[model samples]
Target: MARASTHPRSCGLKHRGFGRRFALLLMPLLVVGCAWGSSSETRTGDRAVPDPDASENVTFYPTYGYLEDDEWVVPVRYWVWEDRGLVSRVVTRVASSMAGLEPQQVETFRHRLRPFSGDSEWRQRVTFVFEDDPLGQEYQVLDERGRAPRTDRNGVVEGKVRIPAQRAEELLAAQGSQGGWLRWEAVSRDHSGTGQAILVPSEGTSVISDIDDTIRITEIPAGWSVAVRNTFFDEFREAPGMPELYQEWDGEGDVLFHYVSGTPWQMYESLSEFLFHEETGYPEGTMHFRTVRKNLVSISTWRDLRSLVSAGAETADRKYEVIAGMMEDFPDRTFRLVGDTGEGDPEIYRSLARRFPGQVEEIVIRDITDDRTLRPERLEGMTVIPAETIERATGPDAIVADLRWQPQSVRVLW
Candidate 1:
């Protein structure tokens, strides 16, 4: 547990002299869609119980903190917003499995960052941004008990910060556990929005689709053929059975939906619309883009000198930058990445899985036109389901059965 003596004097004080500085240090850790609750010993949000019965309105409990000896700081807070409920399902699952275990046994959580249930609309979304902290190079979340949440998530509960089973039960009873997540539940998908819907599933299956040609046809080079592939599109279009597939799998239960694309911010508007369009829309998941700029110099400048950078310059490295940014924007939920064989989608997804293996449940790769030659050998030890499309992949029970196999790494890690 976190020792009260080590907590900064600004822990409970709002907007005091150190409040802005404290908030600045902690803000980077405050992302959307994380499960949370107060520990019986400590009233921190990280100990919240599960919400197995999630509705359209999901509440997220964000855990934020920095170390006592280290410069790392985080301002974790809860945000109730609209989410596609993609990683939300995954986190809920992992959270459920780890419910009774000690905090030391818990692993990392993941999710993409986008608009929470608020002013952001279908056409354009208000992205949650993060500012840099000079006090430290590493970021960490500290529980109220003053202990860091476990990262390895192995079944040996020890030095980590967690709520006891009895405490979790008490909190769940008080908060109405939905989807197995305690303080934070998912927002209902039925709420009026611009995003499309598949036939609502009795148990929602999160759609982790690619954003490029999977929806919008963006022009890009593909070997000897024209670089322009149908998946990396500019305008959102309905791919063959994608809409129906998303709807069929759509539901209010344990579904974690996401769209992990390789498109840079240059196509942010187009990509955003493609994910939330009316004709071929699905619920909005975290939209990953390229880095704001390449190289450490660009990164430093963007983090410290955002106002000076041009929009194009920011969009240049948006892909890589967005990956890191999402960690802070949505800390509660981990991701199940879905992308295409085109471009650098595989590479990016692989890197993410590698950096936070526990957070990524699986990688679903849609093979466009039998281009196995272009595919990677593996995706960071996780199962990579290579399919032609929605039907080809989920067509029969064969593919689904294959997907049921335990990932060698996750099984070992778990």
Candidate 2:
């Protein structure tokens, strides 16, 4: 494990307690222009555009949950498009800049926009039918009445579906020792969706990873300008060999991945797409995201950049809470906590180690900041690897060896 430097630099804006407090106090005033319709109009006329429907706009985000009693209580969510055309894009771009979106704030904006002053197809009820060979041999249609409220009024539907333990067990048996993901398909009246669910073995390693900075580059600790450039305008970049490293850890079977990040649920699609293209080899598991309230005010008009800088300050706490919950949920499973030095991952993981003890197998903190001083004292299972080291071909193997994780013989069935 990498050791923390004895002489660390000041921990940046996130470490300053006063900055966050002041931002909270000014939140109300700063968020006043968050409404979708409040932005200056760019169109020539007040003409209505055809709204997108389920067939063209619906998207499903893959997520997982622990098995409770006799079922796998998985969290399933899908987004229906109200509009994905130029008009909505223009509104979003203008609104985001006006709000001066912080990385976290940008996610909130992506996940929570509503029809401020437009013809809304937002909350139209839609029943989703789920089918999985392992869960059952038939399609199970979820009742519309039982579905939970949309995560966002701008067409995001949230709900949970359970797969029977018997079916899950059968699927595992079919995989024959090298447990693989159980595939599932979903469909609405006018759209279709798909995802995979992992039946975590009773005894194995589960890697809990942080997405931004840790794997995907967002330059979170960097101020609002860098955040905006990376998140909104720039292309998504992976942290060197992270994808291969994760794949190496995921070798064969006996390893599961759960991404717990401060990134809002709105970026689910974007992240999913990135993972798909990057071929990170991380299997779809449960993704825990920050709970961002809809900011009624615009993000662009803050009095100073300090307010925007502090927007995601609460993420450290949120990440801690989610990781703690994962520990409680899977008490028997060992974990490898992966994160970066940009935020409070080291402290958070240390606290988790103290709280859960032996359950944590290791802690791998990517040294994105490159300031070794920011690293904490060497703990029993913590290692800080510099980002530069990860860029090499040998980097992935070195990481695996350092973690002392034995690779299993994985069979690719698909």
Candidate 3:
């Protein structure tokens, strides 16, 4: 205007190219100014944006791993119930999200915790559910109400609802004769036997095994020295060439593999699945896990039985129940009870063989101790195998005592 601002740097506002460069230089300043004004205005009167941290109330939420976007997590519960006279612990992983945690998480946790749970005695109900209204809201209210109670960071809520042992057992066994929540049903092992089963012509021979050290190697929690020994060493291992010997026996005779473990029925699937998966060395159809009952009656007295009965003989009741069930399924089967001298297997099997004389023809036990003072009085009529001899006999090419040892030649089918 005053001679058109004579300096070359003083570009006219009307000049489009010069104006474009000028606007570009001012763009950052403009954006900052707008943002500043918008923030001030928002603080003064406009609606505030949501605070993600404030809205998230996850302090009381149970510790869990991540989940993907838009993915639905299912809730599952592992119910422990009394099946027949024996307590059958089955996992019924439900698909609802109202229980407590997700089923996948529950299963993962179970898998992780199982190896360490070899000696746990407490039977507490574990529930899996989702984050929801009502129950989840109740958790929120409790958290809010008890915020000032000063928790121990370990999340032990003080004065929690503690159910007495008797009452808890009652609740767990309230359904029917086979009490409690019924959900999981494993396909009958016989029905699910492999399409290609290795079959030998009928010989009527059956194999019985000890539970604790013979098959499972559950490092029993004894004293620290014993615990260390059990932990570092497995008495439950399949002794050297036992599996191959059993396989060859299965190939030759109409043999059945029976595992007579001292492990409780609560460990049925844990032991069964482990043997089936990890110890595939054993013959397919010949597998069993001894189920036991532990009832705490008085201060220093507990009725422990392998077979389940209505009253008394808890362990025997469980064993007899399973053995009876097997008899019902497979009649004319002759069993040879194999056990170790260590725990109650020898005594228990002796009682069983005496009870069912026709069914149990032989009783073989591994002599677990060298102490001459502890040598058991050999039972009449039943064959007791020395531990060393049995170890040698389990090798693949070892000659069987006799083929005619089996009473009858039964039709061997898968």
Q: Put the candidates in lDDT order, highest first.
A: 2, 1, 3
* Location of the lowest summed lDDT over 10 successive residues in candidate 3: 56-65
Model 1 spans > 4 angstroms off? 1-209, 223-235, 256-266, 286-321, 324-334, 369-414
Span of ten consecutive residues with least summed lDDT in model 2: 396-405
Which 10-residue span in candidate 1 carries the lowest summed lDDT? 394-403
Across residues 1-414, which tens digit of lDDT does each residue of candidate 1 receive?
111222222222222232123222221222222222211122136443434343222112222222222222333322223343343344434333433222221221122122210111121111121212122122223456765443121101112223334444454455454433333222223222121111111222334556654544322222211111122111124544555555655564456554544443224444555456665456544343332221222334235223112122222233434454444334444556666554455555676666666656666655553445433363344444444432222111111111122212321000
Off by over 4 Å in 3: 1-203, 218-236, 277-280, 286-313, 328-331, 371-373, 379-381, 388-414
Greater TM-score among 2 and 3 belongs to 2
Pick by lDDT: 2 or 3, better one:
2
Report every candidate's CA lDDT: 0.34, 0.55, 0.33
lDDT, model 2: 0.55
Over 1-414, each residue of candidate 3 has an lDDT whose tens digit, in order, gives 001112122111222232223212222222222222121111224443322222100111111111122321111112222111000011212211212334443443244323222211122222222222122211111123433232221111221122233433343344231211211121221111111111111237667666554443422212122212222111224444455656677687457665644343344444455455544466544333332322223211122221211112333444445554444444466877765544445556666666677787677665544212344464345555444322212222221222112212322110
Candidate number of the best lDDT: 2
For TM-score, candidate 1 versus 2, the one ahead is 2
